[model samples]
Target: MIKVFYIEDNNGQYISADGSKRWTRLTGQALYDFLQTERGKKTHFFVDTDDNGVAIGVEIRNTELASNLKGDKNHSDYLKQVRDESGYITVSFDYFETEDGTSTGDEVIPNDEDSIENDVLRQFDLETLRRALDTLTEDEHALICALFLQDKPMTEREYAKSIGVPRTTLEHRKKLVLQKLIKFF
Candidate 1:
């Protein structure tokens, strides 16, 4: 069984654990050194005691949050007894199957065909959009850039006020420019 311990805040003494007829109290550098070990990584644990408040049992609880407190989710080799390997499966994948599947076909390696096609389509669409943007008039280009292409964009009212134009007129121009870009697409 894994060792467990709890802090005794009243005495300010690091009475680590006194369970199963074994008692250990540590403080200062000794406590720090003990924590550096594998078993002492967790800060809290459960300790059952008798009528005298003397520990007769120790418990180390396992939980997803507790296990991940040290950010050891990826590299941790502990907790193999209850571990389910299904966690390794990518949830974003379109399909999944157990190793003992009914299909007799040989295992196939994954290919990037879908990602490559998506990348090509994405690049083509960006190029088409750039070409469409190039056709806009100077004022339309400036308005579009202020609204959408900048690090920080301005609201329609803000852009309209900056250019000394009514919000309605600015909105109308934006709608027209978008319709033109759609037509180009």
Candidate 2:
């Protein structure tokens, strides 16, 4: 009753578990905690067991698993000692589950089309932008909108006169609004 779980690497190949001739014995509670902590980090996990339903070793899915496993060699070695003391030669793992599930491997990195579009749009999120505009006092919103719509960029003084706000107040509001909008981008 042993189950093995693993995932293929970016290269479309799974690292062979067979090369590591080590057995780490863990109690059911310990295994559950390990699975919970390692779940999102790796692709999968599995339990190895005997025909009599006796628990054996466990297999982890990715390089993250290996890194976590090797974090403290002394602890792992102790677990191996425990397994040997209990009489299992080496850990068993499921191979079929490790088959590559991704159609596109690391040979090709997908282009960031959305990022390119965002760069072109600059600080634009229709809803958030609109809400940010709405939050502005009417005069401030009108002034900012006018400046944005204009083909040319205007200085704070020019914008202040156009919006009819004092130069200092206009500059302050502009800074605050711009700061809020920056998060959208």
Candidate 1 lDDT tens digits, 13-68: 34445533324455457656867977667554444435665543232346555445
Overall local distance difference test of candidate 2: 0.59
| Model 2 per-residue lDDT tens digits across residues 104-138 | 33334436986798866764567667776677787
Show model 1 residue runs off by greater than 4 Å. 1-95, 98-111
Candidate 2 off by > 4 Å: 1-124, 180-185
Give the TM-score (vs. native) of candidate 1: 0.44
Model 1 residue 119 lDDT score: 93
Index of the highest-lDDT prediction: 1
